[model samples]
Target: MSERGRGDRRGGMSRGGRGGAVRGNRGGMGGRGGRGGGGDRRKGREGNNNRQAKKKGGSKVIIEAHRHRGVFIARGKEDMLVTLNMVVGNTVYGEKKVVVEGSSPEEKKEYRQWNPFRSKLAACILRGIRDIYMGPGSKVLYLGAASGTTVSHVSDIVGPTGAVYAVEMAHRPGRELIEVAKIRTNIVPIIEDARYPAKYRMIVPMVDVLFADVAQRAQAQIFSINASNFLKNDGHFVISIKASCIDSTVAPSTVFSKVRDELIENQFKPIEQISLEPYERDHAVVTGVYRPSKKEKAPE
Candidate 1:
């Protein structure tokens, strides 16, 4: 399969720099002033006016269900891809939060903005990939879950009924992932090398979906081995490949073609291949089913 044509970078969603940098709010008025002073009163009035103007200028946001289940779009000042927050009042990687008021106080719902620049999965979605193979109540096995950035979003998509087994080899990011898991009970953080799935076999079961974002040179092999151990037959697999990491000498298209062949040889039926351009250069996301079940013919 060929990668999708590269499109212009989406401008509406917040762009968190590479490595999931925090995108803090900018252009806010700041100053210190004495209480009950005329300046303070004037500033208060101006603040009130600004809030009123903002409210008047179409600041009302409406949440609409996205094509993919468990994913949503917040439309207002800017359209942003969002997932319902599993843990209320917590920010995983400093993403923008959108709160929607319900009929009652307890009914209020919050969503976390998903940045494509910070996540390959998000990039894939924005690039109009046909299927994610994941939704609410899907059991996911996530490899290379660094600091639980995308893992947190996956947890949100899976909701409470589902689970995410996050594996990270490095201790530094593993620690952060552990902290993220502590808050979201659905996530199980396993700090171990993904190359050796047997080491953590006891903690992980055969999952419905396997996602790998490990940019290692042997990433295809790693995905194949892990899929063999933890992925159920006919289960879906989504893997992000960094062409440079695999081989900088060859063209990215060549690298993707080679990886697609490797996956095919390893019992993966590739469904779609999409380029993660604008958000990530020279990167591609490949998704397909593992050991797909054969269809039975109709009675003749």
Candidate 2:
């Protein structure tokens, strides 16, 4: 009777163990299926996000050449200057940046950032000065080239055929100008005082334009002297006059009038005078012809 009882107990334990194994298998399969579905859903969301980004802005960059010659407009969800990089992958003074979209071994194209805030010339350009006179292949005699920041942009505009004679008096800034000139072959950096144009007489030839940004009491005199030496007959002159530099106590209008009169007296015919009020207060850019020959002079 004891043996029969023990055999019956063993058979019952075997059946219970088989039932648990079948239930465990079903639970395991359901958990795996749920996990797989969750993973697929996450992947679908990631793909949707990528598609949306592409629709918002098709590409990373889009550059269009500007209407103005030697200028370009860059659009990367924003608008900015399409400038040529003087030093590849390097900035002179924390200016904007634009990458060259298409380039090749035979011909390399590069673009750098032109910031209006940093460069007065750039501001003037944006202000719509009809003829800057410093275009491609133009010979420019630039006075007061501070650190060559503007000079470098001018170099890019003028291209290899053109030349820029940058003159800065101070030693420290002159050193920086030299570095910029080294990179851009067309620039001729002259570390000499602009007040005395005769000092560097041998280096500068008759230029198409004479640009002066000196902040001296006699700003007109400095420009007159330089134009007389280097500007060709009927050549243009763009002078940036700062009223405070001339006389802080005097009214800004008074200062501008005085400068304009002085320029006419020196034989520079004033064509148009524009005030850089919003960009720069108490500052004006005077554009005119330097000593036009009697034949070339227009009728009043």
Candidate 3:
């Protein structure tokens, strides 16, 4: 597995600025206080108005449900992928937060901005991948959950009813993942190698989806073993393949094709293959069902 790093702090699409699509007017008050303290009082009133305006500016952005369940699109100056924040007023990985006021107090929802540059899953969604398999209440087994950056968002998507079993072998990132899990109870951080599922087999149960992002030469093999261990019959699997990680000597297309064939050989029916372009180079996301259940024939 390759080391994961926070690539960029920018949380949304690059339309005209880096501070996201939403912006507010920052009114400046400059001048010495008057003899009666009128200037100071006036400046104070103006500052309060500016603060109120700033708060109002954020509300202009609209939240709409995306084609995929549990995923949403924040529409404003530019479109951004977002997920409802499970832990309100708390942030994971320092991503931007959007607060949307609902009709009722209990209806108020907070969404976390998902950056494609920082997360491969975000990139896959932005790239128009058909189906992710896991949604609300869908249990997931995530391999190579480095620092739980993407896992946290997956946690948000799954909400409280669902669970995400995140496995990270590296001690440093595994620690960070544990911290994320502490905040979001839905995530179960497992510090173990993904190659051997037997080690953590007791902790993880049959999951609706198995997602693998271990950028290793034997990633396909790793995915296969885990799928066999935890994935349910007719369950789906999503794997992110790094071309260079497999064979740097060959072209990326060749590597992708070979990996696809390898997955097919392991009984994975490839549904859609999406290229993570602009966000990540020489990388692709392959998703499909594992051992799809055979449909019964109609009466002849």
Candidate 4:
């Protein structure tokens, strides 16, 4: 049996819809996780009221930041909108210092940002994923961390106390991710294909969340293999599926169904699935819980 519900499609709002519309005070994030800063303060429209922080040195560059709801607006050279609950500043090794302090992150709560592009996480937010649980101290397995755009946000979310094992198959991007991780203590970038978690088993700890953005032909299998070894029993697997990546011949729905079946066989219970349109074409971010059988459950 299978259950279906709404999925996270945050940054997707910028798609199909006119990108220019975001240029207004609202500032549409056309899928790039629009990082805005500076200029006159706007009205009391609450941003993301979650925790916020920063990394700096002897007032080298004081990034003026404001909190609104779950949004963090940094007034530096440019106006940047990051989630207060996620991470504080860019993970730049030599200069990565918490300029401002923030509340500790939650271990098992889903958090989103107001990014309109560059990451499926942003799309998932715009789509309204009420079940997302990316918070502090969370051990996340990021499948596709390209150039560390969304990885930075995730690093902020997990905070210094938490850990994020970013897995990227591409060497170039993985190198950049490693560099980024150098600044942030929590993010540990691993240069390996997410398909083979066993090879990197020594590095990846049991994770609270398995976030996969790798759009591949055998993505479901990829998620299954990785989840089997690393996903915690109560953990959640957040996967972004691209229809084209699965099969161009059959319908997108078929691809999703097959993927779900594969995950179910792997002991992952389906939670939610929603199409990531506008932001990402023919794509979806699916959430599932990994609950072992009574026999598989370890002694408490």
Top-lDDT candidate index: 1
Candidate with more favorable, higher TM-score: 1 or 2: 1
Alpha-carbon deviation at 124 in model 3, angstroms:
0.9
Query: How large an RMSD does model 4 have?
Result: 12.3
Q: Which residue runs does candidate 1 get wrong by more than 4 Å? A: 1-49, 53-58
lDDT: which is higher, 3 or 4? 3
Candidate 2 lDDT at 191 equals 93
RMSD of 3: 6.9
Please report, in order, the local distance difference test score of every candidate based on alpha carbons: 0.83, 0.71, 0.82, 0.62
- Relative to the true structure, candidate 2 reaches a TM of 0.76
For residues 82-157, could you state the per-residue lDDT of candidate 1 as single tens digits? 8888887888887877766667879767888898888899999988999999999999999999999999999999
**Number of clashes in every candidate structure?**
0, 3, 0, 46
Q: 1-300 in candidate 4: lDDT tens per residue? A: 111111121111112132421211334223323343332233111221110111111111223322212233333322333443343333322111213332544332222233545668767766776565677677888888876767777777667777888888999887888777777677888888877788899998788999888878888888888888888887888889888888999998988888888888888888899877777888888887888546667788
Ranking by TM-score: 3, 1, 2, 4
Candidate 3 residue-wise lDDT, 1-300, digit = tens: 111111122332332223444444444442354332435656756756765655553324667888888888777556677888899878876676667666787876787888888888889998999999878999999999999989999999998999999999999999999998889999999999999999999999999999989989999999999998999989999999999999999999999999999989988999999999988999999999999988999999
Model 3 alpha-carbon drift over 4 Å, by segment: 1-52, 55-59, 103-105
* Candidate 3, run of 10 with poorest lDDT: 1-10
Candidate 2: regions farther than 4 A off: 1-62, 65-67, 86-90, 103-108, 295-300
TM-score of each: 0.84, 0.76, 0.85, 0.65
